[model samples]
Target chain A: MTPVSESLRAAAGTQRVPVFRARGVSKVYDMGEVKVHALKAVDLDLFQGELLVLLGASGSGKSTLLNILGGLDVPTSGTVVYRDHDLSAADERELTRYRREHVGFVFQFYNLIPSLTARENVELVTDIARAPMPATQALDLVGLADRMDHFPAQLSGGEQQRVAIARAVAKRPDVLLCDEPTGALDLETGKRVLAVLEQVNREVGTTIAIITHNAAIGALGDRVIRMSSGVIVEHVRNERRASLDEIQW
Target chain B: MRALNRKLLRDAWKHRGQMLSIAAVVSVGIMTVLTMRGAYESLSSSQAQYYRDTRFPDVWVRLERAPESLRGRIAAIPGVSAVNTRVTLVATLDVPSVDVPALGYFVSVTDDRGATLSDLHLSAGRFVSPRRRDEVVVSDKFAIANAFVPGDTLRAVINGRQRDLQIVGTAISPEYTYAVPPGAIYPDDQRFGIVWMHRDALGPAYDMAGAFNEVVLTLSPRADTARVVAQLDRLLEPYGGLGAYTRMDQPSHFILAGELNQVRSMGTMIPAVFLTVAAFLLNIVLGRMIATQRTEVAVLKAFGYSDLEVGRHYLQFALVAVLLGALIGIAMGSWLGQSMVGLYGEFFTFPTLRYEFSWILAVLAVGVSALAAAAGALGAVRRAVALPPAEAMRPEPPTSFRPGVFERLGLGRLLPVAGRLILRNVERTPCAASPRPSASAFRSRSWSSGCSCSTACNT
Candidate 1:
């Protein structure tokens, strides 16, 4: 076993279960006369209710790993098991059902529909979820209770990102996959958005994997994995998690 | 409403300018279909009712001379129901108000008007009196054209003799619904007229005191019209019979049928052209919308919306526009159809012409428009559904720019940056640049050509 998987297994032994187990995971994108190897035979395990941060540069394939875990994509050659379900073997419809039931996603640019208000955007998840929190409650959890009626265009960047967070958590998903969720905000706003995600991870007891390129933000996670050129270069377990206020850009 | 539906409504409103323009095109197409079809139905029903009320003849035969006793013999033929023999002659008239000499068709009418096959609907005054040989009933259109009231007198040369006839009545007939003179294609009300006289007076004026020159007959509902026509022709052959014909060959009915056929063809063909253009516009607009909303679609799919759900959401956008256009078209078409029927009443002498709104046609118009819009939106909807959420979440790659035809020819360097950018965009979106403008140009050209053709036909 690789050192990262051994550390993950060792971490899971005492306190938690491994929610996602991936083996020999690799992804290749064929762009007509060029084939880009996004991931190279990577192995990973994410523990239940633990916050994990994937730190990488722009082309380091952190987003691809998160997408594969969230059932948004299938690796070129890998086996991914989310609890007991074989995600790599799943078809499109099965993947949709899996995502619907277990996964929530927050995107970098805050992909909240501009036409809908903050509450309505949250309701987009609650409407289709099997067991969901009320949309208003979700917004209140994200610290946007008073701005629930404002459209995305009317809100500031930080507020829109909060609404996106509320939308992702409204469904009460088992895992939240965030791809550069604070990438578009200023340093202070990014810290606030990260604080909301931290709060949600602690309160809801949901497994959260946040992908970012900022090294300082890695101190806020229970575990941090750094990747370079489609390969994991280091895996570290933080002895003490720092609160959002103490973390700086 | 669900959040997705709210988003749909807001999106539609945000693009209201494009949606309303598309709706306008759809409304015009539907309006044409309803107006022409509604007018056709009104004219046909009115003509049928008028013909039924007048007991219009099924067959008419004109001969040099046939004895009055031949009426019974013609009536005894199998399938023949009722026969009336009458004397008809042409007379030259000298109208008091007009400088040009007019032609009059003089037909004999019995004292009991119901005794004949084709009876007139008297619009003013009484029918010709059996006791007054000088009294005549003039055609209503001719009377109105010349300002000839009931008490006016008309001088005519009958059998080379000038005679003064008192106009006792003005009437319209089912047989003369489209009253054009013989050998004329258009109705000239001032130059041609119909004069109805008592049979006793007209028979002697035409040098036929006891015989008649024309025979009109009705037939049984189940009768074979061709067989009866042949029998009548055989019986009148010894009396110098001109070949007999059914009402389908009658000049007035034939002309009216031809006109109705033209209306029907125009109704279908013109709407097809308009709808084709609307569909093309819809394809362009919806395709661009999907292109812009790529990230939104990916987010929805990432939230676990199925491909079908996303596709249905976009399709509802098209349906909303179609519904709005259909409602507007129905209202406008109904009103225009009524006005068209009223206009027809002035030329074709229908006692009553009412525009009948057909619910089936309205439903069909909406259905057809929906189909067209759906067809137009299919490619866009498919593109939205087929997009992989993972790929769509990322920003689209920049379009690969290369030297275009003008640049390769060395002329692009002469233009400014803005012009070069425009040329580049046009080159990148060749379909967007070419088809729409060319289609609209072709539409306008064909429209003008059609207008000029109709104007020429009218003159």
Candidate 2:
């Protein structure tokens, strides 16, 4: 796995040196006659194995930043350097390789194929991944081993989301991006989902960045970013990330 | 590739209605094209039979009178075989209560022999013998149509004078080529009647047989028809001649232009309609399926599948639909062609109308239908396979409806249920006609799957 580098050892829980460094990142949307600045003059850095939470309201550019970091969109003007490689300036094939070797993503709705069983859904990813564990073992890591053969329809909403987590993490990527992972679920289900995310962080030591507006979620992250009107208003560093189960609702 | 084909077949089965509609379109087209060919062939063979049975003479000579020297010269012509002179005139038959329409009777100077001319059919009784005075024979067509038989009585009008005659036998002339009945545009068997009598007997009693109206000859077996006809016409020119008609002069009523061309023209026009319709249906159905499979395409792309691979998957549908249509069309066209031949046997008198098979039609049908199916899939496949892998992998963002907008005018408070329904509807996709909508989560389907390899792989 390209994710295993000696410098990433310090990123466990907290790291000072930047593993993902950005300088003057900007993403502009040209709408026929009007241009909307989705992201502007953003500068940031992220370290390995640290859980960073992005906080913002709708249109605050939190999702935009996450999309760019996950290789889903290109920046209009910027330099995003992940280790020795420049991501923002890379071509489509290069971005694809970066995503496959270093990044994994989880979205709000789970996005599971309804016709496939939970295990098969995760296996869809692991089969193409390099240096990955078996899909069944990955699902077990997410606490969904017993429901491997159950289809998405047969499982509860929380169980399906957990399968999604297994699918993303099965490749053992260095970076995990979650865009509102628990946004669609109820509080109890959300808590269970958060516990799985926390275990993946502690065990796999993946540098996770979750984009959400839930203030309580910030309590569980090593670093917190507050965004408003396409700009980062505040960046707060926590001395310690509270254990997933220890954080109060 | 074989494994992919097998999977493709299963998916096609899952979407049977759509596939069959495409096929039906092609089958209909092939049937139309084939039917034209069949109907024309049937009519042609039928007309040919009519001509042969009538025994139409190649060269005919008619005159008010001819000298003895001229008759001998004509009979001794290089290509002449045998010759017979006859007096023919229109007459009406008088039954007990039925006065039949005008008919033609010939009074021959002598009984026709190979030494003379005897190309007529004697279906039942004997022909007029030499030196016979009162014996007469009526044609089989007249006897059969009028319920006449051997030894039946018949009356003939000789120059507006009634004369009783014996219907000694029945025979068929060798010069009547039409089943529609001689001198009638439509079929009227009751209108054309023929009888035969000795010229010596008719001339003494009726006094009109001495002046012959026509002279017929049976040509030598090896004679050139056109050359003989020209020589005979020149020899008989002083006797008053009009024209000569050979078997080749006749054109089949069904094939006035060209039998093959007629068949082809009909074959082309009809099936084109159904095939076009089938193509349109395929395009629409496939387009809808691709649109619905948008997310799945992204997932597959994320799994390292090239856009070309994904596009080929969609193209399989077009091939399946079109080939199926072609197969069905071939079967239908063949069956209809045979059935049409049988239908024609009722009025036609051919030995048989042979069934001709054309594989070209089958090829054309399949080719056209496949083209249609492939054309239909273009938009869907293009749209699904065009996106960048990353774009495909991400779920579409939810379209948010502002709660304040719904709350305005106190509508949200009054129609809370409706508002909730609208919100839920917006969240769910507009999935309607797609048969295999995303078909479940991304699972790598492989060839030769079994328990040995599947246990660790199912997840």
Candidate 3:
């Protein structure tokens, strides 16, 4: 048995609830002439308020697994349960509602609307959220309070990524899913972004799952799962997670 | 404002040029509609009211010499409410500093104004008095065209003798509102005019001292005009009568009605072309916008915006463009409409011809433009919402290309790089490159939209 399942069993013995439970999940894409198997029978459990790092090389299905857990896509043949909701059985509309109420996603490229200021971009998600943090407060959490009025074009790449982070967290979602959140930044900037994500998870107690190709980023998480060829090969629990300043590329 | 609405405003401002282009097309369409519609209403209504106020004759009969006693007989006919008898003659007018001899229809008016069936609206001067036998009242359009004023003297060949007539006044008559010479399609005011003369002078000049050459009849409201015309023609047949006809056959009214129909048709046809092009341009622009904004759209979807919300956003953008165009059109159309009324006054004489503003037309224009803009945005908006969030968030795979069908037909090697590039783009967006009439935004709209516009005008 993997260390992740073993930790989960230990967690279950302590009566700690999980945020998500996914079983036998597989995704196949039909490209007309050929079938591409993106995800193969994957079973995973995401515990409440814990930081998880999905570490893998490109095309190893880590992002696919994260996407499925976030309800961004449907599995070809599997069951995914989020809290009391059955994500596998949910239609598009139900999934949209689920995402709006419970999920926050941060992408590699900060897809901030160019026409909008940083503050306004965050307000976009908060306006539709059932429960949300104030946009200014969210920006303050991401250390972008002074740069709220600057448009995406006027900000640096690291600042834009911070704004994207603020926009995602402003909704006060229960689960935060980040897919390569610092893929395009310099070493220092990437470290700064990781620090913000770490701070957000610590302060808000929001469950976080970050998928990344950089193996070093895995040291910051409470649990790290290494994936290869659409399956987890290794899972380890950290007794002491490393701080942002102590880590180097 | 909500964040989404703020984004809408800033995005629209960023693409102001495209939005303004769409608005301009809509403005042109509305302007055409309002201008022609305003002109038609002003002309038809003014003429109808003028004819009613003057109690214009419904039927006219012309003969070589009809005895004055025939007036009583015509008045006694069933449905004939009034009969006006007068002597008429066509004379050649010779004005000073003018090389060509102009045609003049000289009709005698009664000294008693109340008894006249076809009355004149004096515009500038007094009517010709009976004592002033050589005085005349010239048609208003003719006077304006020839630059003649009251007290101007004109020489005319009256009954084979040259006579000098003084222009006492300029008058507008419903009978000569759109005066055209006999057998002429359009009015030539410079070469033809109507001169109202005294009965005592005109009868003697034409050598018909006690006989009338023209008879005008006004019938009851429900009178059969054709039957009355046939009866009058037969009764005056022995007196060398040529024929009798109702107002529908009158050259002035015929030409005026034809002109009004033309205005209506032009209003419908021209705008249809402009609006159709506008719709096509809007579609192309929105389609391009969707193509470029796929990432933003995916982000919006990931942020929990539903497909309906995204669709509404684009539709609202399209509507905003349409609204801008409609405002420009309303201003432009109103100005054009008023100016056209002034222009029409120069050709058609009316007592009260003015620009008539129509609120209904304005409303209709706005409604139609809204519908057109919405329709143009529908396909683009749908495509935007149909983008899956997962695939769209990542970089799209590069478009694949194979050696086209032409290569299989052995024609690929003959094509140059530029030709292949163009063909590849054409294959990617087939509508943009095709020669099919409906696919073209500019050229083919002229014919197809013209047909649609004429139909709209008729309705």
Candidate 4:
């Protein structure tokens, strides 16, 4: 039998640091003749319960950096430390383990399974998590309690996005990575979706990162990181993040 | 894994119409194959029964010369019932309605065994008239083909001479129709037509004055055929122009043997065609299912489900689809098979065309369906198992994008404003969720074929 000594040591090491940290991470993809640099020496961190907005132009690498921080990608050269476990150097199995235990991801498309109802969709994620909130409770937090039985097709576009957020947050994840969570919604629906994310952050204390091309969406975050040409050109901090309802779309 | 299984079940349910069509196809093919085999067997047995009941001559030898004194010697031999020599000739009849070719055989039998050999009831039919002045008995099959009925006036041409005769009645002959060989594969013998007339009918026409042409033999009770044939061959040798044969050397056996081979060949070939199609279809269906679940596969991987676990989930759908299809197919196949056999019974005389349940066939249908469904589902399982959690979680692989080189060639922009823009994007990319797929097409075709083949194996 393998001893648990190292695993015990690693657990203690992970508890001492912030939930996630990235230093000079870069991801360069080889597309035949073009060596596309998707991420360029990006340094980032996510503290507990903080909603960080990642704003950038198209092809500016906001999604790539977010993917790396969520343990969904590996940095080509730099290190990504999730607590003490090195996310970048981890093998496939270890990376899978990291995803299951620590992170929940929401894509721009909402990605709610078309066949499943709102509650069932959230239940699918929660069923696999280490510790998870009830699917009903998660939907209720998103203000979709009454529409839990409706399928994605039956729900409005904004309603579907809320269900996706519920599914992501229901896992009680250490980090929730939203890659343009409201990208497909109109202004009114987009506000409703933002409010759900804000509620999850405030009530469940899950660290969240929202990636988008809209600069105006940044006003609702604790820290705003802007990228251009695959590089982070600006970082701004707000004294107090504006309430999602108070911020104009 | 369990959650994946639930999802897979949902997919099958969503596509139930397609599954049903496939099942219907499989059932039809299986039934056709079963019915064909059944009809062939039935024809063989019925022919055997007709011959046995009537004591039909096991072998009849025909020759040009008449053995002048062979009758007594041949009759004395063991297993020989009676020996009679009669002239046989083919002639045309100048009928009241139509002049047509008719075959006639002259017999000088000591007694009548025509009814015995036919396995029939004497229905308004007299045996050969003692006077033998143009009197004849016709078989049912011969009557139908020639448009003859009871009391119909018929003319027999003997030695190119027309002789008018009264149709005495219709009789059945076991040897007349569907002469089945032992171990026959197909039903219904082709040599199913014959007409019989008495020996006295030819006496005055040829002026032969009591000579004979050939002798037919029926073995004594419990006599061995080979031994009887040897005895008769020796006894008839002195007569100088006679040939003797046992049942094994009969021409009907040869003809029936060939027909049996044809049936066997058909039986072996038809089923294999449907089985191969089923396998190909199953492969396609499985490929599609795996391709569609891009994110779910990654999520399952992240949950630490092993490759086998994921594979098991996908494979479950295949199992359900195949089993359900196969059971429905087998039921429909059997029903259709019986009807097909019934149709054969009309054309071919059968003892009792029974629907026999063959466990081998049932097992074969089930096994084939299962294998096809499993094969189709296999790609998904393998993809899930080999998938790295990180790759699984990442967004799906980008669609195949074709660069607008032609657009850059400058004609695309000048062609039309809106058409060029739409064409440019369409030419460049094909995605999974999009109705027009670059990704899903490859996967869906495999799965659809698999699904369709397994479900429609009969078709």
Candidate 5:
């Protein structure tokens, strides 16, 4: 194990190996007359192969923490170490390298390129990935095998989100960060999208972090962290995680 | 193909309307450039070749009369290579087929039909036979205008005597490529013609048995034409010399050169305006596209595609449009150039006029157009590459809407709801309304200028 994982394991009082260890991370947006503190001195850890949920209401900084963890952003103060890489000190190029090699992200909106078909969307990730599954196989894992030839415009909202998920995981990344992946879908479609995410984590043994405002969806994660105003208010472990079908809004 | 390229192709297809409109504008710009340049090249090359074949004079002088023996002294001037002196006279013609009296410029050819400066390309029949007083060759344009052919007879009153001259041939000369009657700005072939007669016959008829009134000569390469003109004027002054001048002062050559300059300036100015409008349209379209594809850019970056890759994807859209325009422009330009040169053949007679397609010109057109398009696309591509992945995926903040300038000026209450809404919309989306007004203004100005030019041409 690396020194970061060892130290994180000792701090957590458990044998779990952390893929990310962020200490007192903060983010400030300078909106001219006022400074908006999106994230404040919040220390956190994301363990390897564990499905984690970051639950909070709107403006609670849950998405900001997830962004910092995914290397899409850097903290204003404090350090963020992913494995042995110091993401806090990384430049734009180094951060891009980190994202390409290890991190995968899914936004609330599917963000699939409308001009590309489902399979081609997945192939975008596979094209530059060091080691990747075939785009067809990734689509199949997302239950979009039959719709692989369909463009995003032709697919339903939920199906497009599934394609987004397929694109993220095709690279076989070390961790998957999803921010409200089902936020735009209907109840039935949302459940179907969540089941795909659950299946990927269960089958691939990939670490996952999901940020959402829905508290009921917390039962699907191995651990949960509740945030309020830019700081972590509660952190809990679920003894037995519920299946996707059992979770409700 | 890579997925990004596939996306580029499909996105272009989806927006084919805007893309093709931009391409059409680009094509017009390239076509104008190519057409003007091609026509200019055709006129210049044919003029040069005609001048070379005819041994057109470098200097010309006219006087009351100079003894034929003086040709030897004029030829002895420094830098003078070859000289030809002949008696030239103008006479009134009474053609049987024409009601009005025609003007005839009578030039003397050698009795033996030997080569001379300002030679003619024969179109039909033959040159005047040795010492035949009545046999003459007429200009091709005058011959066509009057429907005259070989063996036709026309009466000319030369030096108070009327003589029936028989037409032996018809020809075109480089010296009179843009021939206009004396004191006339435009050619009137029906009222004027050139009549070439044997020197033995024409000299004595004009009371110059062994004398000549006009002199034309060629100069050696690297010779000072001004110095030679000065020296020739001094020698001929005692023989009633009027003046001596080089080809630059020759009316026909001067007019032809001026026309060519017009073509060159048209090639430069018109295309510049067209291309500026094309670039403006491309910038507006691509900017809107990038704005709408904010999330797509974010997703691409978030999925490990580099900023350069994303930027390239958008630039390819512009390249495809420009290439399509270049192909259309090349085809249209070549055809239009051929037609334009053919039109020149009517006014300025050349042995042959051909529009040759230049690969260098085609390459330059494509290069310039691509450069303009890339410049137009630069701002939008930079915006896409600079967007932070995290922030772009989120919805943009709501714009703070307030009363527009018109509303603040107390004009809001006087306007209808629809008019007020439009004002607000224009204020909110300033870019949408910006280029159109300027483009329309430019178009109207171009139209008015074009109308004025056509009216001037008609008069």
Candidate 6:
């Protein structure tokens, strides 16, 4: 068991193991006249029930690495294994299955289907999940239980983002990956959104990884990895993770 | 409902205007298909039923005159079931208030027999009595056109003698259902008519006593109509046969069949054009919509939806519009078809005419429409699914704009800010909407006014 999974077992009162192992993963985008390397031989392990923040500036390959781990993309020349399944060797169908069963993602823009109400959006995932929480329960977890009937257009920015979070977690996947979830929000709204994330991590024991350029947000994570120019520059383990409300941007 | 399906409903409702427009185009195509298909089926069936009920002749021949004794010999020919000999003559009609003389065909009516080939359907009044030599039964269409009913008087110059003929009845006959003036392809009932008179009256009028000018023959069941026609032609050759022809060669049936052929081809051709245009329009609109939803597509993918699921969501949107259009088309076509049948009844004189719905045609229409919509959506759906989630979620790269050669010209410096913006926009994006007004004169005047205003501002 990895250290992060060990910590997750402690949090969940059960034995947990590493969920993802990426080895020397690299991604190259060929632009006809030029080849742009997005990820350069990166290796990483994601365990159960830990909130890991990847901190980087724009063009730092942080988002690309998160995508590879989430099965939304494939590594050009390296292997990524999710539990016992080797992602690099998997076809498109298998990769899609892995994402469906094991991963949830949140984006900078809430990406809630505009036509669907909050509860319906959450129900989208729950309907397809093998074992999922009720759509109502997921909304309650995000503190938007009363607003479940509202459409994304009718809700405020923070409320819509919370609905997106509820939608992502409703499936009760093994891991939750969020990319710049607070990038579009004000300071107060961002803090409230982060607080929800903290609560979900503590309650569900779901291994969570968030990508952001803001260093202040990293204080809420159990581990922080910083990237620059398609490579990791620093990784730090937080001895004590702070509550979101205690930090000021 | 499934969550995805619920999303589809709401999405369609939100864009109801666009959805309805596409559906309207599709409906036009389906409407054309239904109207033509229904008309074709109804007309063909009605014609067959009319021919059968009237016992229409298989062959007809006309000559100067033939003795009545030849009727038995003609009937004795192989496959000949029945024969009728009549005196036929054309006369000039003089109706009141009509300056031009209308042509009238005065046919000799046989004795009142229960079973006679080419029987007339009396629509109004009684048939003329054999004793009343001056009484006549007129074609219903001609009577209707001239506003003449039973007991009306018609003056006809028969064999150089102008005599008053009393109309006793108005009737329709399968032989002359679609009558035309000689040398014309279409009927002009106001200018031409058919009048049936007694044989005793017509025979002396034409100065042909105990003789006939025309013979019509009916063949036995399952007999060859062509072979009988050929034998009749050979037998009557010595007595001025003129020609013996089958029903297919008869002017009324021949012209009607030609028109029906044109309609059938149009049923295929016109709908094809409408459907093709509709499909092309759907493709363009759906492509633009999918392009705008790239980020949403990425988000769906990130939510663990397979590419196929995302594609299916968009396809369902198109199919829903198609189904709605088809239902509207079917309703509209059914109503239009009934109206068309009524119009044809007045023109074709069919005893029974009704719109016939064809299930094969309905199925074909729906199948083609579904195929068209699917084809229209294929390109857009593929693009939506092929997008990489990571790339699609990222903001688009900024577009860089630079000055063009037009901006460097000395005269261009005198242009106003609006003019400069137009020049730069044109340079920045060649495909941008045109800045010029669609009205050509207004576009020239606006350009001149802008130049004058810009020079004044610079001064």
Top candidate on lDDT is: 1
> Which is better, 4 or 5, measured by DockQ?
5
DockQ of each: 0.81, 0.11, 0.67, 0.20, 0.75, 0.69
Instruction: Kindly list the per-residue Cα lDDT of model 6 for residues B337-368, writing each as its tens digit.
Output: 78877787777887778998777887788789
Q: Write the per-residue lDDT of candidate 5 for residues B1-459, one digit (tens) a residue.
A: 888888889889998998998888888878977899889988999999999888989999999998889999999998998999988999999976678899999999884334599887899999888758789999999999999999999789999999999999999888788889999999989888898988889888999889999999999998999999999999999888889998988988988999999998998788778777777777667776877787888888887788888998898888888988898999998899889988888889888788888888888987898888887777778877898988877765554457999999999999997666556655644554444533433333322322211221222
Evaluated on the second chain alone, the candidates' TM-scores are 0.85, 0.53, 0.83, 0.61, 0.86, 0.78
Could you tell which candidate, 2 or 3, scores higher by TM-score?
3
Residues A1-249, model 6: lDDT tens digits: 334334433443334456787777889988766899998877676777889999999999999999889988899998999988898888888888888898998888898888789999998888888899999999999999999999999999999989989998999988999999999999999988898888889999988999999999899998888889887767677888988667999
Per-residue accuracy of model 1 over A163-215 as CA lDDT, tens digit each? 99999999999999999988999999999999999999999998999999999
- Stretches of candidate 4 off by over 4 Å are A1-15, A21-24, A43-51, A79-102, A126-134, A186-188, A213-226, A232-242, B1-177, B180-328, B346-352, B369-459
Estimate, for each residue in A1-249, the C-alpha lDDT of model 5 and write its tens digit: 334334434534476667788887889988766999998788788888889988999999999898888888889998999999999999888888889999888878888888889999998889899999999999999998999999988999999999999999999999999999989998899999889888889999889999888888899988788889998877777878898768877
Q: All candidates' TM-scores?
A: 0.88, 0.57, 0.84, 0.59, 0.88, 0.84
Task: Write candidate 4's Cα lDDT for A1-249 as tens digits.
Answer: 012223322322345445676777889988786899988777666677778898998889988888778776789988889888899899766776787788887778776767677888887777777888999998899998999999889999999899888888888888888989888999889988888888888877888899998888898887787888777777677677787666665
Better of 1 and 3 by DockQ: 1
lDDT of 4 by residue, B354-378 (tens): 5565667667656765675566556
In Å, residue B170's CA in model 3 sits off its true spot by: 1.7
Error of 3 at B232 (Å): 5.2
For residues B209-317, write the lDDT of model 2, one tens digit per residue. Answer: 4455577765777888788778877766666765554544432233233544555577677766776676566666666565556666665555444567678877888
Please give the distance, in angstroms, between residue B352's alpha carbon in candidate 3 and its true position after superposition. Answer: 2.3
lDDT for model 3 comes to 0.84
CAPRI classification of candidate 3? medium
Question: Considering only N, C-alpha and C atoms within 3 Å, which residue pairs clash in candidate 3?
Answer: none
Stretches of candidate 1 above 4 Å error? A1-4, A14-16, A83-85, B76-82, B111-116, B127-135, B151-153, B163-168, B218-231, B400-459
Ranking by DockQ: 1, 5, 6, 3, 4, 2
- lDDT for model 5: 0.85
TM-score of chain A of each: 0.97, 0.91, 0.95, 0.90, 0.94, 0.93
Residue B179 miss distance in model 3 (angstroms): 2.1
